[model samples]
Target: MPTALDRPTERPADARGRVAELRAVRAQAVAGPSARATEAQHAKGKLTARERIELLVDPGSFHEVEQLRRHRATGFGLEAKRPYTDGVITGWGMVEGRTVFVYAHDFRIFGALRKAYGGAYIVMESQSIGADLTYAWPTNETAVMGAEGAANVTFRRQIANAEDPEAARAHMVKEYKSELMHPYYAAERGLVDDVIDPAGTREVLIKSLAMLRTKHADLPPRKHGNQPQ
Candidate 1:
């Protein structure tokens, strides 16, 4: 009598066939809105979260992961209206054939406002998986807000008085100041490794991935809720 460890394991007839079956089941059970579906949802205003990711990554090379996980909440009476993925998409795919994790916020559902569990899930995923590069394009509405001062005052005022000459001048000045301040703030906090021009994004991502891949194999296992301060 052979022990279980001593028994020869039989290979499945078709690995691809099994993968397809699993993928189909995942699609039916867990998959949320597609990049296209999310885009259509936000067509009234702008691109969806998925659309932004597509723009950021190299074409035809994204291999998404955990795409099927749906929101588990039911008691708030909001579950019916909420998307399966809680308006957030998570996955890992190749940026120029190098592995990188992504979590794109879909504003279509709840305006990309992170509900209780959804925000935490993505934060944890990002921390644990350790993306080589993360592209967080929070909606323009949020990003445009000034952190402090008279410049912030000017920005808020300009929105309401777009036709006013004084407002327009103030707005331009405020915008320039904000742009200058943001990079400095980010550097101080170490939120970004470095900022790059929009046109250079793909090349930068490719280079970053190449650099990350050179590190020793077997990265440390993911630790939950380890977000950067």
Candidate 2:
């Protein structure tokens, strides 16, 4: 099963020259888009995807798979932009002694308890999407939607009726975050397990993985059904 760090299952056919091809691709995968991209992430106080993975797993334990896969999307502006790895890192690594398959990408975070805004985008990779264990950083935005949209839509009538519409909107936006979207609201209510520091994420994950290693389950077989593409 795919975990947070891996989703693609396609692997290239084995052939004589595959080792050389993979070595070249692996070198590219480790570098990311460019040195400038690394600078940009550092500018925003964020780690690159691979760096985060390395931090979470045992040293020298991650064995990345499917690094040569590409997307098949044909239309829109996507046709000509088929980059390798599909902009995600998918593979497995040891967490303590457990072998965990993982993937990394820009995930939809779980909601920040009460969101008061526009149509909420269900994050495709959040706990709401059935993640077994979820974690958040102290600085994560952790909202279902932006505070501005929440205030504008939820308090539309109040803003329009107020003598100072802009002031009303501003107050409502602040109220929305403070009253409904408090940073620790999710952890308080069990929506998320905890709020953690970025530097401590690896240690926390190691502990959590150890705790979960004893849990097991079996899914009942289900009838196949046709689903829309």
Candidate 3:
């Protein structure tokens, strides 16, 4: 009375057939619907669903699960057309030798949430932000200058005295864009520990992690009001 798992070992033919079926399903999942659609996706400066996962994860570490699952939607003739994996690739993999779960939607195969209108597309686009900074959105002009508090306030007063309000605003916008968007400002202000070129990113990260392995920090005492410069 062998179990189902044991049966595969006993019956070689059945095991071979099972492996062949698995390979076929994997091929379908990798290729999506057609070669033409996959090529079009590549042309748009975007990697395919599988390629993205592979690049993010460590080499030969990705173990995809639910590769044969299909959507059960029936209302809009979805039952008649059931694409493999339901247009979503999900699995667990390693990034920098650390375990991570990944999920990617196949835009080519199943366009489930189609962007029909322009506004609808914008709304959809806003949902996928990496961080939420809505709390600072309603802050005053001082917020735009980051932590340069007194210096920025003095600069603002000088600009206000020298130029008209509209002209000051234009200058402020230019200054804000220049300082806030670039990496140099943050690096100079000691907000960032270090900044490295894209080519040395991996090497720097590994070294930083090694250095911080035994690092400890002591939080500074909370001070009331501003300190004198």
Candidate 4:
């Protein structure tokens, strides 16, 4: 038999102690993001990553993988912000009693994932030639109005000018959303090529592409590249 020194130095008092340790570990896993981050997510009318996983899977069935892993990517200043779980929560869980794997990342906290279908690259390239566009609703009105500090200043002035500040702000938001978000207005202003019905999108795009195939315009040479010594 191995001597005490040859055996493990750290040991739980009993089976119950080991079970308690496991509970603590599980608690940390379930905690997900910081309290402030969780609050911000809820404020945006979105569920937390953990919550999403819970909903996606049957209750009490989520078995998280790499819950305690941390990103080792370091340069400039990224080492200071090494993300836990590498900013992604991946696991296997039961959905309707069927086992399914899940990979969820909070785009708000990290970055977005882009998925494209057939001809999407060409469509996006054509669209990129025009003015940039953004969409917002009352649910995320703050993003629409631009920086909160700047928006507050403008809103304050508008409130001062109006007889009822509260009512005026609400009216302003509605009017702004209506006026700024219409595709027809964007087309008229040459911000977009045109808007077409979803059902006829493929047909319309084929015709547009056929005409654009022969269309050409003088363009400047590319400049960005690795600099020569």
lDDT, each prediction: 0.53, 0.66, 0.56, 0.54
Flag regions of model 4 displaced more than 4 Å.
Answer: 1-29, 111-229
Better of 2 and 3 by TM-score: 2
Compared to the true structure, candidate 4 yields what TM-score? 0.40
Instruction: Put down candidate 3 lDDT per residue, 72-161, tens digits, no spaces.
Output: 677977666677777878898865765656666788876532221223322222222211111111111112233334234646776667
Candidate 4: C-alpha lDDT: 0.54
Q: TM-score for each prediction?
A: 0.48, 0.66, 0.45, 0.40
The better candidate by TM-score, 1 or 3, is: 1
Q: Give a tens-digit lDDT track for model 1, residues 1-229.
A: 1122223764346989667755654563233434455556667665555666787676765666655455656686754554455567777666876666777666655555532122442443333356444432222111233334435455656655677756666667666556644544443444444545655666777876687776776855767665343
Leading candidate by TM-score: 2
Q: Give candidate 1's TM-score.
A: 0.48
How are the candidates ranked when ordered by TM-score, highest leading? 2, 1, 3, 4
lDDT of 1 at 132: 46
Q: Lowest summed-lDDT stretch of 10 residues in model 1? A: 136-145
Clashes of each: 2, 8, 0, 0
Cα lDDT tens digits, model 4, 111-177, are 4332212243223332444323322112222122333333356567886688887787776666655
Model 1 lDDT vs. the true structure?
0.53
Candidate 2 lDDT, 131-229, residue by residue in tens: 577776665455656888878888899999999999999999998778657548767866676878889977887888887778887855755562222
lDDT of 2: 0.66
Clashes of 3: 0
